[model samples]
Target: MWYYVIPALVIFGVVHVYTKSWLYILLRTWRRDLKALIRFSKVNYYLLKWERRNMTVPKVFVDVAAKHPHKVAFYFEDDIWSFQRVDEYSNRVANFFLSEGYQQGDCVALLLESRPEYVCLWLGLSKIGVKAALINTNLTGDSLVHSIEVASSKALIFGSDFERTLKDIQSKIVHLNKYQFNENMSLSKTLFDNAKDLRVCLKESPIDAVTEHIQKGNLKDHILYIYTSGTTGLPKAAVITNVRYMVMAVGLNKMVNVQDNDCIYDSLPLYHTAGGILGTGQALLCGATIAIRKKFSASNFWKDCVRYRCTIAQYIGETCRYLLATDDNNLVKHSVRAMFGNGLKAQIWKPFAEKFGIKEIYEFYGATESNSNLVNIDSTVGAVGFVPFYAKFLYPVSLVQCDEVTGEPLRDSNGRYTICRQNEPGVLIGKISALRAVNQFTGYADKVATEKKILRNVFSEGDMYFNTGDILMYDDFGYFYFKDRTGDTFRWKGENVSTSEIEAVISDIANLSDAVVYGVEVPGAEGKAGMAAIVDQTRSLDLEQFAEGLRKHLPVYAQPIFIRLVDSVELTGTFKLIKRDLVVEGFNIHVVKDEIFFYDVRTKRFVPLTKELYDLIMQGKVRL
Candidate 1:
């Protein structure tokens, strides 16, 4: 009897400790992951089914249209387009392309803004096994030519809104056929040589469904070429296969819980992934309605939501901050319950949510070409996503130690990359496997570019992983947080300083509309010194209060050594800050016309960065 009682008591004690310790938290995380995985399995099932049937995106969309023909598919500036209308319009586009002798594997360059027709054009081309190179509409001159030439596009399609842009590059792209789609019935008397009217062609073509036998592509074939944001260099076209499109769409749909009745307000550009694929995918794949805007307007953001009865809205980069700057009149009343996208900083997250009465902020992190993706399902502040410690085998994403400068992984004595410990920042990588659509890395259209992103022999011999080029950290609770880009984090005063963190701090302190931080070389310094460019159109920022706030929020080493005031910050179409030009200009007063200031250690204030001080710093006389 004593032996039995002692064994029972021991078992009870073990259970108690396990439940009381961090293992209990791990259990909850595992439960959350398990639930998410179960939901995601549905996407996998459809993907597998679609692959087996050799069905493409257009085919699936056609089926969805048959089911919800009368439902509103798109809402664009007082114009409502039903599913049936969109489907018929797409059919006419397909017939027109086929009539023009565009065969299977042909490439067509599409330069259009955010509109219902933009989606229909791409969907139509995909139906005939021709891929649409979704060129960024903001691109001009050399960049625009490179985009068109890189894809080996056989034809160019331009919206009437960009007729001048087309004319600028007309001579450069004369080798290819061009078509112009005019919103208004009025046609230009002076059309570029070899350019035809796309509207006339569509009107002449029938609106009936394209012949089933004419559709000649599988789920694995490429459907669209979406370009990466050309922040560091020229935009690289990322291959978007039918399978990849389905995975991205279905994955986001399930994770965000987008219902069929929900109307998604999409003000993002149509050439990018967030707006082009994921936003329109709600309607094309999940039976939801989409409200498309030509461009994102912070002032009219909520008003559009109210007008369209939008239940979900999309945002990226500095959109939230821009919205926060606006007055609270339209923000308070809206039907938007949830907002989804990436780049929602932690500083403004709570304020934006509370002010707008948003119930959830589904912040996510992913590159256009990378297979790795993360979403904060539980609305955890500052967390991009999480993977439980016990569940790493299931989701093969890891943070590995790497060279901070070149962003190359550092291998241990055994020649295997070392994984970072808890709360330690490292380059994020994801294992690539061809066994499933979710794990596959479709990569860029250029083979050299594609190969550069693949990291071979990562954890084990012959194992490949996609280098995400982003630094991230995970805590004891398994919530992963984005730190900064590899090159964006610079070593200062023998400590690594994250520009993103410092930018957030500066933006909050100065009450700035935008802030861009970068590393600039100091002549005698061991490493680069931190510099910040803040948007202050009126030059009304309180320097004294800003310096005080910086002292309170950041460490001495993490504080920016120099600051430049700019009237406006150049941003990408998606609102991401462009730092290439600013980095090159550095802190030279001659090169930079803007007002510059430097931190004064002795005075404990920010003083003007004069030519004398600049020369002193360059000559290594003044310490950073």
Candidate 2:
């Protein structure tokens, strides 16, 4: 035994020495490769020299359009736009903008849908130096006005279908001219030439062609004003410079193995950052085909994948959860091989991939205004595998003893933030400095709102850090997992209540299609009580049965205090439920005509909630 042990020990020692020597060589080579990657990514900055000559973004698109004129650029059901058609439409719109006196560096608010017009307008705006403020078309009243004003937009372009939304905010829109796409262009005017059965090109413009606003704009100059998804609070617009967009595009494409032949079935809304910037930009820059969809449809997701022969796609929220719930939705011939996006849960990752025959699941992390990103590129070459994305993201996050009562970051004996050890959940704050800083909000800076979002001197006396307001945690493998929004997360009695968790659960009420969960003011409660507004896919909700099923699935505090059944849940154009609207309505009969019911705490049944009934219950005139 000793002789064998000695031989093994000697071999181990020799291998250790050789392994260390090889590891050093491997590290040096990786460092060089990483530097090249980082340098190529920053084509607008100091590393612009590394980029190929005459291959700038707009030129790249023009080259592609001229070469692949008949190739499909955008599609929905049967609606289609070829590369040449897209370019021509964009040229016409660019000419339209030029004729309307839109100069370079001017801001234009685009409030439209996922149509050819929107895509052409976006590219055409890029051709000129006009920065597009992709306004959420679903936004109404103050929100819409605030977003438009925040962008300092010189002009607003909206669809004819949104006349009411425009009217609601007409009194509040800043000193800006408005144009209706459907109305301004005569209905008689054709979107494309009727002469060509398959293709069309931009004709010689009788209208004054737009003069080049910027002859040689720096890549660092921002082109898109992207509004945050607003799961936490009012949306803040993020600055996305051309350099950053390209970096992320290349980073994501390389990280996720996106190639020119790959086709991505896009179901995300075009207004969102993921849909336009990360998803579409990755496809365009990587020379991948984009099969466009108007919006997400869980029941038809698989069919769409099969129809497009898509090899990749993007997702967010509990999109997978809904897809999984549609039992038969997974049963279809799909050519999908890989998917690149973010916000997939660990619990569903494996199942989602196995269920769909996906070979790669490239979950990512990056925001419109964030510089740091993590890519889960751990799959083995030609092998089905999994690994989570990892990065410090410019900050050390920990489950410190924050002020539980006021919900603020806490300090310890050392007067420094108490870093939560591995696997503990905590709020994430990105360290801002010369070497690293999240891209700040863009637009004419609104100091009032800007300052509100930033955290000053967080680490030192005068340094600043951007507040992400997202709770995140790292596992043993240094993989960060998303938890919940900071203030939006709540505790109910003895259990932590994830609003997203409840929303996901309630959204699975067999017949319901969507749900938005929020906490509301309740008498005798230390914290707010949970409430949800659900949309019924099977006609409507059964309050009694829903309450019983909810009780079976949830603990006492986790169950919603009030259930409101609505015709449909109102959401942003990006498909995020607008909680502020729901919270304001809050089971108030006068505000919302939806049926409201109260959970009978004792009986575990729901009863119709009436104003008099509420008054009686609050006054102790009624018992649970």
* Number of clashing residue pairs, candidate 1: 0
Clashing pairs in 2: 398-420, 399-420
Would you list the C-alpha lDDT of every candidate in the order shown?
0.82, 0.61
Which sections of candidate 2 miss by over 4 Å? 1-60, 63-70, 173-175, 183-214, 229-233, 379-407, 412-415, 433-445, 456-463, 488-624
User: Which residue pairs does candidate 1 place in steric collision?
Assistant: none
Most lDDT-accurate candidate: 1
- The clash count of every prediction, one per candidate, is 0, 2
In candidate 1, what are the lDDT values of residues 362-432, reduced to their tens digit? 99888778788988888889899888776777778999998754466799999899999888889899999
Q: How far in Å is the alpha carbon of 422 misplaced in model 2? A: 1.0
Clashes counted in candidate 2 amount to: 2
Worst 10 residues of 1 by lDDT: 227-236
What digit string (tens of lDDT, one per residue) describes model 2 on residues 286-311? 55678777768888887888887787
Q: Predict model 1's lDDT versus the native.
A: 0.82
